[model samples]
Target: MPITEVFKEEMGIGGVLGLLWFQRSWPKYSCQFIEMCLMVTADHGPAVSGAHNTIISARAGKDLVSSLSSGLLTFGDWFGGALDAAAKMFSKAFDSGIISMEFVNKMKKEGKLIMGIGHRVKSINNPDMRVEILKDCQTAFPRHLAARLFTGSGEDHHFKEAKSYPECERFHWRRICGHA
Candidate 1:
C-alpha cells in the first residue's frame, strides 16, 4: 500500500503511532537491508577515481557538490576503470567451473589485476592487513563490518604512514618517556 493511503486510513494520532511503529521496527523490513548497503557505500567515501578526484579538488577549495561532481567525472573507465573489467573476469572464471593456472593466466592476459592485489602506496609484497580488522568485526556485526572496515582501514593506513616519519618517532618516544 502507498504511504499516502496508509496515512489517510490511519489519520491523526493513529497515523503518528503507525509511522512511529514503522520507524521503530524498521530493521524487520527489506528497506533496512538496503540501508545497510547504503551505509557501507557511504563509509567508503568514494575511494574510486571520481570520488578521489572530487576529494583532491575539494582540498583545493571547490564548493561541496561541484567538488564531488568533479570526482565523479573520474569514475569512468578511461580514467582508471578496472572495477567492472575485473568483475567481468571473475564472473567468467567462476562460471567456467574451473580454477586452473591457465584460467589465471588468461585473466592476466586480459589485463585483470586480481582484485585487492596492489596498493598505490604499499609495495607489491606488503599489501595492507586491514582485512584482519574486517574479519574480527564480521563475527560481531557482519552487516555493518564492510562499511566500518573501510573507515578503520583508511585511518590505520594514515596512522601507519604518520608513524613512519622520524619526527613522529621522536615525538612519540619523548611523550612516552615523559620528556614532554
Candidate 2:
C-alpha cells in the first residue's frame, strides 16, 4: 500500500505525527505532551558536546550538512545515547518478568549505574523544570503501566528530581512493545 494510504487506514487522516496522536488512544493533549518533550530535549545549548562539535566544524569551513553530521556523530554512549541503552534494559527486564524495583535493585547490586538516572549538576534540591513539566503530563495518563513503573522507580531512587529518565524509558518501552 502507498505510505499515505497506510497512514490514512491506520490513523484515519494524519501522517506520522498523526499516528503518534492515535497511539494508545490518547486524547488531544498527547500532542502537547509530545511537543513539550521535544522542546525540553531540543538542545542544552551551544556548549553541549553535539552543538560544540557542530560549531567547531562550521568554523573550520565545513558545509552545513557536514557540520551537522559531525555534530550528530559526537552523540555516543556518554552523550545522547543513553536513551537506547536504558530502553533496552527496561525492555529486557520487563520481558523477563522482572518488576521495576527488582530490576533497579539488580543493577544497583551489580554496581551498575542507571543510564538515565542522574545528572552531573541537577539534584534533588536543584531539580530540572523540564522534568517537572513531563511529570505533570503523567497525570493525564495515570493508568499507563510504563509511566507508573518508571515514575515509581525514579522516585524511589531520587532520579525524578534530576531528569525524566523514567518517562524516556516508558516511551521506549511503549515503542518496543508496539504500543507506540
Candidate 3:
C-alpha cells in the first residue's frame, strides 16, 4: 500500500495526535478536548519562567535555537514541572482507593505540598476564567456524558472499579486549576 493510503488508514485526516485519534470509536469531542487542553497550556505570559528565559537569552544576543532551548530548559521542578507530579500523585492515590479528603490528609501528614493547588491571585471566591472556560467546554461535550457514565457502572472495568472513589466525582480539572 502507498504511504499516503497507509497514513489515511491508520490515522485519518485529523490524526496528528496519535493518542487522541488512535481509537476510531472516540467521541467527536475528544478532538475538541485535546484542542482545549493545548490552548489552555500554550502560554501563561511573558512573566512566566520559560518566556522570561527566552527574552533574557534573546537580549543577550543568543540565536533563536539557543534562546528556545534556554527557555525549554527552565521548565524543571520549580517552573512548569508540576503537571507531571500532580498526574502521578493523583493517579497513585486513585489507584490505591483513597478518597480526596484522605489523600489531602495524607499529604498534610507527610508534609508534602500539593503541586497544583494554589494560585498567586485567584481564590475560591474569584476563580480563574480560563479554567471556567475549559469546564464549560467539558460540560457541553459528550465526554461529560462518558464521565457521568464512568462514575456509575460501565463496561470499562477500570472505570467501574474507580467509581467507588467519591473523589472521582468531585475532581474536575477546574477545581485543580483553580486550586493552583
Candidate 4:
C-alpha cells in the first residue's frame, strides 16, 4: 500500500511510516534501519548539498515543501547519494550471486570505488561515533557495515576480512568479559 493509504489510518505518524515500510517487505527489522537513516540524515544539517540547498531555497522565500523538494533534487548520485548507490551496488551484486569479496574485486579490477567502502573523517584509529552507535544495529542492518569500515582504498585483505561483521559482537563480548 502507498503511504497515502497508511496516512488514512488514525495512528501516530511513526506508526504510519513504520507500517508503510513493513508493507513494502524490506528487511525483517526495517523500521529500526529506517529510524537510524532518518536520524543520520536529519543531523547532516546545512553541510550537505540537500540541506544547504534547502536553506538557500528557504532564504529565497520558497515554501517549506518547495524548499525541501529543491534540496532533494540536489541529492543526485554524487552528493548525499551514498545510501542509494550502496543499495544499488549491493543489490546488483546480490542478484548476480556474488560474495562481498567478489564484488570488491570486480570494482577494484574495473577501477571503480565501492560506493560505501570508504570514508574521509572516519578511520580505524579515531573512529566515528555514529558508526559505533550504528554497530549495535548491525544484525538489523548489516549493509551499514559497508560504511563503517574506512579503508584508505579498498585493499584486498581488508575487503576479505570485512566480508561480514564478524568482529562486531566479539569485541563487545570481550569488553563485557573484561578482556578488552
Candidate 5:
C-alpha cells in the first residue's frame, strides 16, 4: 500500500488509525484520547470472549492474522458493541427530553435491560482497573450525551441517533401508554 503524507510512518498509531476511522487528522488532544483508550485496552483481557478466541486460535496453530480475525469476529452486542448501544440510548433519551431516571424506569417497565450498565465478571466491588483508570480521566474527556449535544465537534457521528427508536415525534405514544 502506498503511504500518503497524511498517514506517514512518523505519526503515532493513534493518529494513523484516527485518520482512517474519522477520515481526518485529529487534534493533539483527540489523538491523546485515542492513545489512552489503546493503552487501557492493550492488555490481555482474560475475561472477555474475544481474547479467549484469539488465544484458542493461536494454540490451534493459526497464523497471526487468523488469530486476530477470530478475536475481532467475536465482538457483538454483548461485548465490544455494548458502548455503542448505550450511546444510542443516551442520545435518544437526551433528544426526547426523557430524564435518565425516567429512561431507566421505562426500559425496566418494558422488560428491556440497559446495555453497558453491568459486566459479565466485573462488579461494583471488583471493578475493572481499565474502566477505573478511564473514569479517572473523565473530566479531561467528557463523553456524556449532554456534553455531546453541546459540543457538536467532539461527538462521534454514530451517537447522533438511535436506530432502534423512532424520531422524538413518535414519543407521544410513550406518554399515552404511561397514562394508560
Candidate 6:
C-alpha cells in the first residue's frame, strides 16, 4: 500500500481498537457531561432502587457493598425495566407507522409493555420530566443515537386513555424487599 493508505489503515483501525482497550482500564474517565449527570442523579431520593438497598443493608447491619448489590440486582423486569419497555413499545409503534391506539392494542396483544406510561410513585402519571431530562441529554450530546430512537409514539396519549387495573400500575416501594 502507498504511505497514505498505510497511515489511514493504521490510524483509522488502530485508533478505535486502542481506545476500546483503554476504556476497560478507565471506567470513571467519562466526559464531564456524563459525570455531571451522574452526580446530579446520585441522590434523587430513597424511593430509587439503590437507596432502598442501602437503607435495608444499613438497618440490617450488613456492609455497604452487599446492600448496594442487593438493590442493583433487584433492578430487573420491574423497577428498572420500565424505560426498556417504553423504548421497545416506541420502536414497535414507530415500525408499524403509527403511534395510534390501534398500535398500542396490537403491541399489548404481542406482550410489549409501554414505557414511561405509569409509575409506582408520582400519582400524577406524568413522564414529561424524564422526557425533558432525556431531551437535555440530547441537547448536550447531539450525536446521541438513543435520542433519535425516540419515535414519539403517542404512548402517553394511549396510556392515559387505556384504563388499567390499579394493581398493574402499583409498584412496591418497600425498603426491605426479600431476595429474588
The TM-score between candidate 4 and the true structure equals: 0.34
- Badly placed stretches (over 4 Å) of model 5 are 1-10, 45-128, 142-180
Q: Write the per-residue lDDT of candidate 6 for residues 61-132, one digit (tens) a residue.
A: 988788788877767664677777777878877897985788878857987545678654444564436556
| RMSD in angstroms between candidate 2 and the native structure over all alpha carbons | 17.5
Question: Rank by TM-score, descending?
Answer: 5, 4, 3, 2, 1, 6
Ten contiguous residues minimizing lDDT sum, candidate 3? 171-180
Q: 1-180 in candidate 5: lDDT tens per residue?
A: 236775555557766775566555555655676788878976645547788899899999999999999998888764577777888888998999989899999999997768778864576778789977776655454344332344455444443364312222123222322321
Q: What residue pairs clash in candidate 1, if any at all? A: 50-71, 54-71
- Judged by lDDT relative to the true structure, which candidate is superior, 5 or 6? 5
Residues 57-174, model 1: lDDT tens digits: 8989999998988976676554445566667767887898867587778767987556534543455477544555434433333322222333543233443454433343344323
What tens digits encode model 4's per-residue C-alpha lDDT throughout 26-101? 3334445556666755655544888788989999999999999998988875566777888998999999999989
What TM-score does each of the candidates earn?
Answer: 0.30, 0.32, 0.33, 0.34, 0.34, 0.25
- Candidate 3, residue 93: CA error in Å? 38
lDDT of 3 by residue, 1-180 (tens): 345654665533233453333433333354456667767765564337887889799999999999999999888666776776788889999999999999999999997877677863577888877888876874564434344544554333454466533344344322322331
Task: Give each prediction's root-mean-square deviation over alpha carbons.
Answer: 21.3, 17.5, 16.2, 19.1, 18.1, 21.6
Clashes of each: 2, 0, 4, 0, 0, 1
Alpha-carbon deviation at 114 in model 4, angstroms: 5.2
**True-vs-predicted CA distance for residue 164, candidate 3, Å:** 8.3
What would the per-residue lDDT of candidate 2 be over residues 119-146, giving only the tens digit for each residue?
6457788888887777777665433444
Instruction: Assess the local accuracy of residue 6 in candidate 3 as a C-alpha lDDT between 0 and 100.
Output: 44
Model 4 spans > 4 angstroms off: 1-47, 98-114, 117-121, 128-180
